[model samples]
Target: MLSMLKRIIIGAPLKSTELGEQKLNKKKALAILSSDALSSVAYGPEQILLVLVTISAVAFWYSMPIAVGVLFLLTALILSYRQIIYAYPHGGGAYVVSKENLGENAGLVAGGSLLVDYILTVAVSVSAGTDAITSAFPGLHDHNVIIACLLVVFITILNLRGITESASILAYPVYLFVLALFILIGVGIYKIITGDVSSDLHAPIGTPVAGISLFLLLRAFASGSSALTGVEAISNAIPNFKEPGPRNAVRTLMAMGLLLAILFSGIVFLAYYFGIAPKHEETVVSQIAAETFGRNFMYYFIQGTTAMILVLAANTGYSAFPLLAFNLAKDKYIARMFTMRGDRLGYSNGIITLGVTSILLIIIFKGQTEQLIPLYAVGVFIPFTLSQTGMLVKWLREKPKGWAVKLAINLTGALISFLVMMMFFITKFSQVWAVLIFLPLIVLGFHQIKKHYVAVGDQLRLTTCEPIKPIEGNVIIVPVAGMTHVVENSLNYAKSLSADQIIAVYVSFERVDEKIFEDKWNKWQPDIRLVTLQSYYRSIIQPLTKFIDTVEKKASESNYRVTVLIPQFIPKKSWHNILHNQSSILIRTFLLYKRNVIVTTVPYHLKK
Candidate 1:
């Protein structure tokens, strides 16, 4: 029943041979991988105005300059990561680049930061998407957190189904979103050119309540930096593309960057010229749409697509996190389960884990995008800075053809990212303190996991010349509940083994006639010795475990192996298991850790 439900939700199991066929093309890959970066246009420029508006009404005019700065950084990052895609086509992104050019510690830091960023991506994107919905229907505003969590679950299941499947499912809304924004931008530009401006276009700018400082500009820049969060995703997932993976990935990266630049700049420019102010009940983009299209079908269409693209933006995190986790797991820094592929050939464990974690963040932050934004950009820029620095180091060391130009590009990216990261730390220190604290702790956790795996390998490893030690014989002890077919089956298997002795032991809480028990044992004629012990406390496992311990000590003294066979009867239906005694399971659980003791369950299947 459970299997049928899983099949229905996630679809049929896919074959390993179908993996190459699952890769996405440039058009579909752009939609899937770049949704997070593109969707940031829904909120990125707004984040800048959100910061600047707090200082004074006139201060919001500075959003254009801040946005231009963000665009410059985005260009540098696009150039730097295209180089990354070609340099390491296998695709580990910043983590691999830093680890190879830099050292192990730098690699771990980059990996940890990316992990945090991916999780935040899901939380923030979904929350902002929910905000768009609530903006359209104020009645749903109170339930936004619940709505955001449900969206995360939906996207997670889509990704778990397979990469190609999700790309096909999500591509329509992504393209529709881009088209909607383009229409909005083009119409808004034409209105400005033809002087069909809004009624409030010439409203006087408000007086400044406070003077603008360098710190204020930096704060706005830092806030707007969220626009660049998903730019690194393409470099990290080159293998997800079809033939000519590196070439396809770089092309997609360039396309995503170009789209993001135009969308972000156009939105910021329109919002400034139209004099759209940030509002508590509605989003900046929503207001711009209302001003441009006048609440018609076009206005609602823009809102619908914006909400969809924002919600689907979480798809970027779903796509990248599992692959990043696979790389980390391959390096032995995380559990090996993350490295295992499911029936669909997706990293099921990593996908499910990312979903659960982001849901938790959404719940904790109450699904407020502004509240979560403070903790967002810090994780992003850490890896951006590290990736640039790692590439710079690589160029200096290799000095390949055109290395000088590459070095200059990466150097500029590294410096700008580092400065922006420092501004995030300084301006939002109170909110981002937790992320700063978690970065080192997460790296330390990676080291500890690696140390443990290394130690286990050392113990389990064997040399070619090493000789095996032989055991003397087996001492079999079967823990029985009573004389039944299950006991007979266990005793038969024990007798088949070449053992020195075989004994059946039982623990009874109620007093029994010794003479009657012995008579019954003799009547059975099983030819196996039976030992029964009375338990004063009515505890079955404690008394049985003690007997096994005594037998193990004696067996170890003689260099013999001790085997404990637990007999149990199988129920035809899984729900029927609750009707029977579970003492055999308890006995097996107790003897698991005993020295020189091996516990095995002998099942007697019921045809019913």
Candidate 2:
């Protein structure tokens, strides 16, 4: 049943020839790999508002400043990641960066951070998207968790089908939403600056907080930083691009950075200009849309587009988690299952795992965007800081012509990112840290696993030993059931051993059929003499033990050695035990009690 389920999940094993036919090309690869970052524009603005709503009604106006900060960080991150693409283009991302420069522990920290961040990306994006849809359609407001889980299952199915397949379907719609967002923000900005926009527009039906403190400002900044989550995704995907992969990847990164900055900043400014304050009860995007576009076509349009983009955002984690797992697997830090690509040249297992985990988070949090937002920013910034610091370490080690300039840039970026990460941890720790404790635990688990592998490798090392001397009059009595495949294999194996003499014997229970026994013996036609001992009580173990004891007594008296060959069939299938049973282990145990007799097994494979 488990095998059947595995087959259903991953499909039947493909022939060698079928593998090459399914390889993904550059365009298709980019679609699959780039979707994560491209999808973030949908919920990035909403996340900022969620944080600000807790402070004061006017805090939402600060979304513009928060977006500006995110844009600045995004730019720095893109440039830094471009360096990463050029330096480690084989695709390890943060792991490779830290390992090459800062050492293994640093690499593990980076990898752990990236892994946690990817998971949060999926959960936060899907939930936020559901929130947008629910705002647009009141009926769905109560079923957020259910809807989010269904979306996750749908995405998992799409991914299971293959990377190129999912990419081809999701890419156009994602691009469409990107373009639509650009238009909406651009037009909205124009209307705002020209004083044509209505100032009476406010977030629909939800009260904004009245007072704020310094802590509120910091919290808003951290929440807004969610927009920066997918900035590293392109760096991780560098190897998946076309030839001149690093250069193409850098270009893609720059393009993504510029687009994200413009769209995120523009939307935040528009939301603030129109008095769309963030409220605990409703998302700022939904509130703004309901005001600007009314409860009619435009409001629904923005909501629908946001939902599509959010669903697609999960593609980011889908692209990242597999590559991260692959890198760890290669370093022996993770299981080998992650290292192999699927039939469609995708990491199907990793993709499905990410999807399932994201769905579980959705269910646990009941798909509340507000609830999940607190847990979102820390993991991402932790890696962001570590990767940026790694770049500084790399820059110092290389000491290039522009070393001083690059060092300063990286140092500043690292400091800023690190400070923000600290702020996120401090302000949001109680609210979200408990849920995130698993991140460090996962890292510790992988470290222990690596240690176990090292220990096993050390234990298995071979050493030189003296050769055995043959004894005169030594007889190896190998017990057999019949001339079955296992028995024949055992006889053949024993003959090749450095033994003085070999003897084949069979023991039968009282219930055994005489005709079957005779036919089984005839098949092998043993070159060596065969002996059979019978039991009156239908107990093979007791009879075999008595026979071996008698043979050993004779051998000991003659100063000879006795060895036994036990034939055994190891059950492969779960159902095989119902059809046939063997007592090789019991017989071997009895022989061990009698001194001077050696026992060995010849195994036969059973169909699984």
Candidate 3:
């Protein structure tokens, strides 16, 4: 029944040869990979306004300057990542770039930063989408956390189904959201030129908070940098694109960046022109929509599409995290399980891990977008800086074509990303301290995992080992709980092994009459000796394991093997098996690695 349900959710398994068919074309790739960057325009402009609004009256006036700073950084990043896409067409983004040019530790730092960033991207995007929903229908305000978590689960299922399927399902909403925003921007521009819209924009002219200083503008730019969080995803997942993947990926990255620039600039401009301040109940985008289209069909359409694209934005994280994890796993920096693909040819373990981790973040923060935003851009900018620096280093060493031009671009980008990351740390230190603490811990964990895999490989390598040889003989021990067909079946198999001796042992919790069991044993006339053990504390595994150790010690000295043959009863129903004590399973687990000891199971199916 569980297998059928899994098949229904994830679809029937795809053959390994069918993996090549799963690559995405540019159109689908744009939606699946760029949604996070595109949808950030929904709140990115608003984040800038949110910071500037603390000044009371002049907030709208300063928004454009701060937004322009973010745009400059965005331009540098897009150009830098294009180089990343072209140079390392196979993908891995900052982790690969830094690891190759910088060193192994630098690569792990980039990988760990990206891992944290992807998780926060999902959490923050879904929370923002839920905020859009509640803006349209206030009834859902209390259940935002639940709604966000459910959306994460749904996106996780779609991704687990495969890349092609998720792209097909998510592309429509992304395109629709883009179209709606373009319409909003075009109409707003026409209205502004024709004298149809004007505002003597005024915010609460009251006490001035912290004066309008350069520091404040930097803070706003840092907050707005969240819009650029997912731009590196395309470079990270070039392998997911169709053949000529690097070319297609670069094109998609350009398209996504252009869209983000236009949409973000237009939204900030219209919000300032219309005096659309950030409201607790309504978003800046929703407010701009209501002002432009009047609470009508187009307004609700904008709100609906905004919510959808914001929710689907998590698809970007879903698309890249698994691929990055696969790379780390291949390098032995993470678990080997992450290297294995699921039936649908997706990295199922990484997908599930990202989903569960993001859901936990949503729950912990109560689906508050404001709280999660501080934790978002720090992780992304770390990679942005490191990736650009790594590229700059490569240019200096290799001096390829246009190396000087590429070096100039990356140097500026690295400096800007470093400044922004530092601003986030300085301005939002209280909220982001935990992220600062987690980054190094995650890197340490990756190193520990690498060490374990290395030790395991060293122990398992056979280059210096000798050939196998047969043992002198075998002494088999059969463990019996009662006189039943299960016990008889095990004894028959043990006798067929031609062992030097076959000893059947039974362990009892306390003093119990054994006359009836002895009589039954005599009646059966089995040509084997039975030894009974007493346990004062009712610990069955300890007594049984102690006896096995004693037997194994004596057998090992004479070049003999000690085999424990356990009889197990199999019930028809899986749940019914739980009713019986799992002694055989416990015994097998206890002696799994004992020297010169072998454990085997003999199953007797129940008829009832």
State the C-alpha lDDT per candidate: 0.89, 0.73, 0.90
lDDT of each residue in 303-372, candidate 1, tens digit only: 9999999899899998899999999999999999999998888899999999999999999889975666
Q: Model 1 — TM-score against the truth?
A: 0.95
TM-score of each: 0.95, 0.74, 0.95
Model 1: lDDT equals 0.89
Error of 1 at 407 (Å): 0.4
Runs off by more than 4 Å, candidate 1? 198-210, 464-468, 513-519
Candidate 2, 305-358: lDDT as tens digits: 777887778887887788898888878888778878776567777877788788
Candidate achieving higher lDDT, 2 or 3: 3
| Shift in Å, residue 391, candidate 3 | 0.5
Which window of 10 residues has the lowest lDDT sum in candidate 2?
463-472
Instruction: Identify the runs in model 3 with alpha carbons over 4 angstroms from their true place.
Output: 202-210, 465-470, 593-596
After superposition, the stretches of candidate 2 with alpha carbons farther than 4 Å from their true spots are 1-31, 130-150, 190-196, 200-212, 279-281, 363-370, 435-439, 459-608
| Highest lDDT against the true fold, candidate | 3
lDDT of 2 at 247: 80
